[model samples]
Target: MFAKTLSASHQHGKRLSEPRIRQLGSLVTWLCLSFCSERLEICDFWNPFRNFVNLEHLELFADWGRPRKLVPFSAPEYGLTQLRTLKLRGYLPMEFVQWLLNEPAHVEELQLCVLDFPGIHCGGHGEPEQFFEAIPPHMRDQVVMDAIEDRRRLRGLARFADYQDKAIAPRSLACLSFDTIRRFKKLNKLYLYKPAAGRDHDDLEVYFSVSSEFRILLEWRDLILATRNTLEYIIFDQRPVCDLRESDDQAEIVCEVSHGDSYKRFVDIVLPTLIQGETFPALRMIRLFGFEPYEDDPCKEGPQEFELLGESENVPALLQAAFPEAKITNHIGRPIFIHKKWGELYGGGDVLNDTAGLLTIGEMIMY
Candidate 1:
């Protein structure tokens, strides 16, 4: 009872004794594991974790040895029934995340970095029958399978993957998969990491196509619609859709979401269109990083080099109807302009410093 939190780092290339793990699982309320090497088997912790009945916060991060495949959690119910916050980094398998959400872990806040989703393969893009079947019947009508037609038109494009050419479906579903979240009745805060476009300044327009971007947008809409009764806050980290404009004198990045792969477009166009004037009464706040904050007084600020979209005054009717009472904050400039990865990871450099102080790797807090 005295040791309420435990943080362990495996750097010496030795397997942690199973007895010690089982012992600590019963004693610790917070558990953080940092595996420094790939030699330690990760599967060893699955059963031991069942003993962590008091654990409310679980953080697992590693620089290497992300699991290739995760066997189902053998128990009928998860030991982490009281889990409130779960953070997983290092490219966790989507199936594992699906399994956790499907079970009885009523996590309120989830932060995942570089989760494994299917790429443009046979199942998601070429033959999407399985993907469609996975969607719950109640929500199935909302999803529109337009990736097929889009891939058909751009068959000859050298950059795009020819999903039609693939012989069989990949092991994982390629489409935006959020059906499991329907089981999470109390989930309120979701934090996800998405790579920004236009990292290479030379090729500005080679990112996601309009159709692909729209599909992702629809997925977000469905997620909100499903959880509209309880979910309140949502934050998207490292999300950027911008272009690099270069001239003889200078070069700079400008953020745009009119028809591109940006969250701004999701708020401005997609949500408004899909909601059809419906309002998310429970939704209170939405935050997006890698974009400038909405400035109320345009005259107060001087001429800017980079163009930023999603001004509050531009489209009031759609914005007002869709969110109605929520506060939307778009902060930080385009991802390409940001210097530190943490700045993009959090909202800005200042917020990054603040977050680091509060949530370190091994620090513990008593609720």
Candidate 2:
């Protein structure tokens, strides 16, 4: 189940109570709450989970993929011993951690990514340690990588060298993505996304800064060393920083990062780096999440939209030679942008039932 809240007032269990929760107890297996906050209290707090007897997966987040809070869990009330997978982000209550580890749950594997530095730039409590200290020893290795930044990005490469000394010793492949060859010995999947900018990134300035051309190359090199021995898939989420309008037919302009060296860099530098390394023995596929920009002329009489073209032809060869034993997928992102007949915009989903030929450009805004 997915639940999002504008504020912390949504009583997730209000609709489900005591005996009623038991109705779907056998059927309910997963529960996920991604929100900005979590306020724990008596009464209806655990009401929804009372009869979640078979719940095997539970993911609780704070501040929208931030971290989960460490609120005490007084009782399971009816003995919820079936939990198997627990993923916690943000702050977590120490008392509950012990309960999850001690009782029938004995959750062995944990998934978590935390950022608790005053300089983290994220809106919540920036001090990361406060959240981690609340976690018990049984859950330490479960901590995934959380990127380290010194105000600006790229130029901040020097910081990764000292990461081993930091508490919680972040070692997840995804968290330390920005700094390559940082030492996630068992890392398999790596992602390098040009964060889509807009309201969702209001604090972007404080998080990262522009990197020099050489610095970008260095970033690629870091990726090479890090993935040399372990990577299996490389997913690149390419989105331009320029605030461009959502695609709305001919009038709406497509803000494609593929228009620049981003794609070329991946082809010319990043890909080549994969083969040059001694590792990457497990490397298989490289996926690029972007598409080339094209023009539309509906008034001139033609197809409704652009062709469903994927990555350029030559990329497959480059990836294949690097990992002659693994399969390669040049999965390209679709250029279809959501534009409502009314003047509204959206990110995902096929472009339909709306103005499909207009295009515009402005700051990238997302709800």
Candidate 3:
């Protein structure tokens, strides 16, 4: 045997028996399962794969088209100690995320697409509500008293302290406890795929407040701060803020925050906080997709090619100054310059193929 890599995708109705999986455990060093469907019974069979102690890289992709219940797989007495990278896609259970963060694999590179935040309230929610039962009796009582006293605040070291012992579905994206995130002590490279635009955003808006998106950015800021000492490379994949257009004489940069006024508030009010405390010495690179050069006018686009815009011009500058030691690039990995004046010389899309190396949400899931 001794296979170096084993890859499978879109196995809609396939099943591998326990003995077969155990056989492959001794053979394969890397495994990828993609587009797993409801018929796969992943949660029920996940533990068997833990026997693959030599597995170094594991990639799992679930069918996002069909939302299914993902139960937490019980933690094994031993872990895949040699595993170094874990990539997951589609809906993942909160408890499962907790199990992973509990140092089961000690992965250094982690990629996630979407995390399912189950509703905490009991009753008909399509799935069984055993999340509350996962908490210990003592913690359950304390959680109730804290809720009664309105002491479940999202700040300081006490942030997410209640959720530390057990997992509870956060009501909103902003409320996702950091205790689960802070456990990624060995995380060095993180690639967080932003929920795609259109249907995804629309669904999120219906489920959560529009402001929750902006608030999640604040949450991400704190996440970065918490992991600043170890995290080296991070990428936030998102949609472009503006479309770059050019005519013969001049270029037009049209920018808009599609999520509306809250994102602007986040930019004005919260982003500066990223630079307030100690510098992130370990951060080597930060790539933010969707947000590029700052544009003054959103409505009309034209050759105001050389105009002087005031405080707004320093927007990109602030991000640059914040991470003095890191190289900040756009989606195409081209270095973004801090604009001193409004219509200063733009980088002019240095990469010939602007979309090169850019991975769409679909591409990310498939690959």
Candidate 4:
């Protein structure tokens, strides 16, 4: 086949059918696959995809109706070494996720579909540690850190005049629920496609529950530690699911807390984790897209303004770590956290361009 790009969309119960089968050379470099089903029998032309050894992009979506699925139980790995960007949508199993995290993939940029993990935390259900341990061995020992002794400890130990690989341990991770960050050592950019495809951000709390939601966030917070050296940018991109009303609380925690409410809890945990100064030194920018956590419902007309999660003793360092330029802004493209003594922590009006682009919804182009 002389094809250069392949895009396939399969509705429920449909086999991933092709119009006419043809042999393609290494010239085919892009493959976009979307799917939906509950039946477990999702078959596609795996051999043809394999022959396209030059395939550099794979955008996959397996939209199973439920959080859990019983898809083709043992889908063998398709070896495609040249793949550079991997984007996943729809429901996924833990096994398939582990396969994506395989080290040899060497994906420079990744867009992860936010999905619920195996959250079985209750009496007789099993302990959280056991729940995590039950995952495959390759995805083990990834407890993220609160704070580390030093950056030297984060990198592997030394042997002789060079470095030592006693083991390439993910020792300094921020100990969040998600451990997949351990494999993306060389990743330059990571975009979290959020709770569900397009406009289902609220389903995160619904499907995963509030406590598990926080755990997911904790992992997201710790992700900085693993990629502090290589990771450059992060975007929390979410779209609205409804215009009726926002959640009663953006997130309400039943567990114990230093801060009383949900927003405060977030401020207490997430803010501190990223602002530690000693971590994510290589991070140039962290971007927040979509609505403010406490904003009023429905899309607005005359510009948007976000409330500032203002001052604490740590605010200065937070500014230093993330704002080092004028990247921080409110929804209306206004500066919320302005720096005076901390130097120019943001890019001034140029940050407004990003806000404009992101607000365009479906039109926002991905590079």
- Clash number for model 3? 0
lDDT of 1 by residue, 6-45 (tens): 2132322444555675686677778776433234333333
Put down candidate 2 lDDT per residue, 1-367, tens digits, no spaces.
Answer: 2221111224444443434445666678888765343243322222344455677777654331223432224546444466656554433343343343333323323343222321222312232463345333443233212222422222434356443222111111122233224533454544443322111113111122111222333354565565466665555444332222333332212232344434544454455566664666666655544423323323224543433223443555666676687765443333322122211113311221111221111111110
Residue by residue across 1-367, what tens digits does model 3's lDDT show?
Answer: 1111221222324545556756877777888764433342333334445557677787765432222533335565655666678776544444444444445336678765443333222111222234335333443454344343222322222245443322222122233355656655676777754321211121112111222233345456656666677777777654212212233111122123323333343454346555677666677776655444334333245553433222233334676788877776653222112111111112322321133355543444343
Ranking by TM-score: 1, 3, 4, 2
What RMSD, rounded to one decimal, does every model reach?
8.9, 14.2, 13.7, 15.9
Worst 10 residues of 1 by lDDT: 165-174
Provide TM-scores for the models: 0.57, 0.38, 0.54, 0.51
lDDT of 4 by residue, 299-359 (tens): 2224433323322233334545455752442231111111221111122223212232343
Q: How many steric clashes between backbone atoms does each model show?
A: 0, 39, 0, 16
Candidate 4 regions off by >4 Å? Answer: 1-28, 38-54, 66-70, 73-80, 117-124, 130-180, 196-208, 238-266, 290-322, 329-367
Indicate the TM-score of model 3. Answer: 0.54
Q: Distance from true position, residue 231, model 1, in Å?
A: 1.7
